[model samples]
Target: MPNFPNIILFAIPFFILAMLVELFVTAKQHIKSYEMKDSFSSLTMGLGNVLLGFVSKALVLWAFLYVYDHFRLATIPIIWWSFVLIFFADDISYYWFHRVSHTCRLFWASHVVHHSSKHYNLSTALRQTWSGSFYSFIFWIWMPLLGFHPAMIMLQMSISLLYQFWIHTETIDKMPKWFEAIMNTPSHHRVHHGSNPLYLDRNHAGILIIWDKIFGTFQLELKDEKVVYGLVKNINTFNPIKIAFIEWIYLFKDVLTGKKSIKNRILYLIKPPGWSHDGTGKISNDLRNEWLIKKKTYDTK
Candidate 1:
């Protein structure tokens, strides 16, 4: 199989063209979800990701190949059924990687870059993480060991990512219920980007929605509640470097000087973002639980 870079190079032009079309449509339709500085920052982030990937992917590929050559259970051939099998396997891998990224402060430090932008548009999809490629691929290391070829896994992973590109938008609202039920549509993805308490850390599926449904991370978009894109506390800056590493900086700062014990400092890295030893931070579930209590009180009243 061809390398992931070679396979994904074919999609870069299409990604650019699609962004242009989204920009055109936004202008024509009076959509105000996009901003110039934000879009440029996103593009730069994407370019940085690709440039960094050219080097980092080599290390990741070496690790995958080493496992594939030595410990693979069986030789998985490049057959049609193999693609089908990999689709589910890779999607599940992505679901867990995404979930873990949101939960662990260490991983969230990298993933927070993608969510740094407040805009919900095609360009937001281009807001890839510079540091995510370092640890995110750990989620799929088992695939090569389970007999899937490294190239095959890389190819399917790229396809999954390409499929996700278009869903990061405000143009298409809702799809057919059946389609939305089965696939990750714009509506589903919008919920994922939402900073709303109810939507935080929900809808973490890739390519297919079944994993989210089965795993209880799925949340439907409510007709009465609008989705607020970006983090609960917005970063409020356009610097790509800051956007990429601000979370890491904050994590280290908390661990070093947040008045926490050494054990708690370590736990802060493993615990969800927004966790604090002094009872100040709020994790996603904490936020969701607060929302539920408020909602229940409002309903009762």
Candidate 2:
């Protein structure tokens, strides 16, 4: 496996400092941004993710190396041009991984930990998945096979992660119109975090907002519809352990007990969240369509 300085370790102080600044600003501005128990739960989840990452990352590196050693098309040199390419390459990979995580129940089981918090603040960014590193690497493993060095792929991944931390806060509002058009800003991410029917599963960008716009998953933050941060069905708990693993618990329970058919059981894993064997449960698109129809009717009235 290739070696690179772990950029995330160095960013720890910056993360804490930024959170403190945001906490102070929100309090002074009289914005209800952070909750004591909620922020604490997010911090605890972040700590667990870092701890679990030690083992999970080792496995990821091994897999990347295995593929790179055997199947690489060509050895891409780590020059300036390569870095430029990998930035976009890794980000698009993140776009797809994030999009899939929202649309597939198996991946969502881990990704939901980040959205479990009802409070959207700097601390909310720290609410990462303990299980994601184990399986999420599958999304990025192709980079190595494409001849991008593991070290380059890993560095860009960290850079992308670092860039995203700032966008989690509600402190900074909109960026310049041009910047907002091209890059992911707090405004864009706020919609991503929102549980509103119109906002669910939208804006799955990593660093660039362009992918969402290109892919038709983009939903602008509406002035009238305030973004509500949390799951459509909030977990209603501050326990970090529960917040991290509750979706997995629910997912397996649904598969094991509710349905008897093997196809239905498999669908419970592959299908989006809120998908049901019967025509009862509703996913994000379902809820969004219903809300849009009602809004259209009200507007005409």
Candidate 3:
């Protein structure tokens, strides 16, 4: 198998070229506005993500190779079926990982970077988490333990991620019902990026849309409903360091300064983003009320 770095080197240029073509083709339709601030942040975050992925691949492979050698299981040949199984297994793992990333404070710290973009475009897709590897490795460890070769696990995951890149665009509005029903498409992903009340965390599929539909996280795009992208309380800063650590720092501060109850403290760590001690933070009833009022105004107009 080619080195992972080589694969990334080959893919990055092609991906960028494709994104540029999409941007040029769609620029005339006024589909969405590209915020320069968010676009630069997205590019930086994407590079960070690639770095984290490289590090993670090295670590996971080291662990797997050591364990396999120690246990005399290194002789196992790479099974082609592992690739097939990985497609499904990786998606299932990604579903849970994505859901948890949104729900858990520590995980959300990294995942929020991707959601920080206020625009939905190919560039927004490139806006990835710099620290996602910290928790994401937990999901894929099962692949090796289940007897899948480490090399195959890495390859399939890369391909899965590649498949996901195209879905980030707004250029392709809605696909056929069958495709939207089973797979994650641009429409499904647009809903996921939306900060609208109806769309929050609605589509968590990695490769397949079935998980969201089956688990009740699925939502359809309503005609004439415009999506408001970005978090309830936008970060409003461009510092990459702050973008990565601000939520985490806040989480720790809340854990230390707030209630003493173990359950409440744990809840602070595991609750939805912007959840707080008094239940009155940014994502609180206040924001929801404002959103509702604005929505009503839009409806009446």
Best by lDDT: 2
lDDT, residue 36, model 1? 91
Q: Would you give me the overall lDDT of model 2? A: 0.93
Q: Over the stretch 1-301, how does candidate 3's per-residue lDDT look in tens digits?
A: 4244445556888888977788787777766557778778788888887888778767877776555445443243555665576789888988988888876777887788888877878888788776676557787776666666667667777777888889988778899999988999988888888888777777899889999988988888887767778886788887777777777787888887754788878888887777876756655334556867998998899
lDDT of 2 by residue, 1-301 (tens): 4567999999999999998998889999999998899999999999999999889888988898889999999999988999999999999999999999999999999999999989899899999999988999999999999999888888899999999999998888889999999999999999999999999999999999999999999989989999999999999999988998899999999899954699999999999999998879999999999999999999999
Task: Quote the positional error of residue 56 for candidate 2 in Å.
Answer: 0.8
Report, for every candidate in turn, its global Cα lDDT versus the true structure: 0.89, 0.93, 0.77
Give TM per candidate: 0.96, 0.98, 0.86
For model 1, residues 9-111, the per-residue Cα lDDT tens digits are 7888998898888888988889898899999999999999989998788788888999999999989898899999999999999999999999998999899
Candidate 2 ranges with C-alpha deviation above 4 Å: 1-3
Worst 10 residues of 3 by lDDT: 67-76
Query: What C-alpha lDDT does candidate 3 achieve relative to the native structure?
Result: 0.77
Q: What lDDT score goes with residue 211 in model 3?
A: 97
Q: Which regions of candidate 3 fall more than 4 Å away from where they truly are?
A: 1-6, 66-77, 281-301
In model 3, residue pairs whose N, Cα or C atoms come closer than 3 Å (at least 3 residues apart or on different chains), thus clashing, are none
Clashes of each: 0, 0, 0
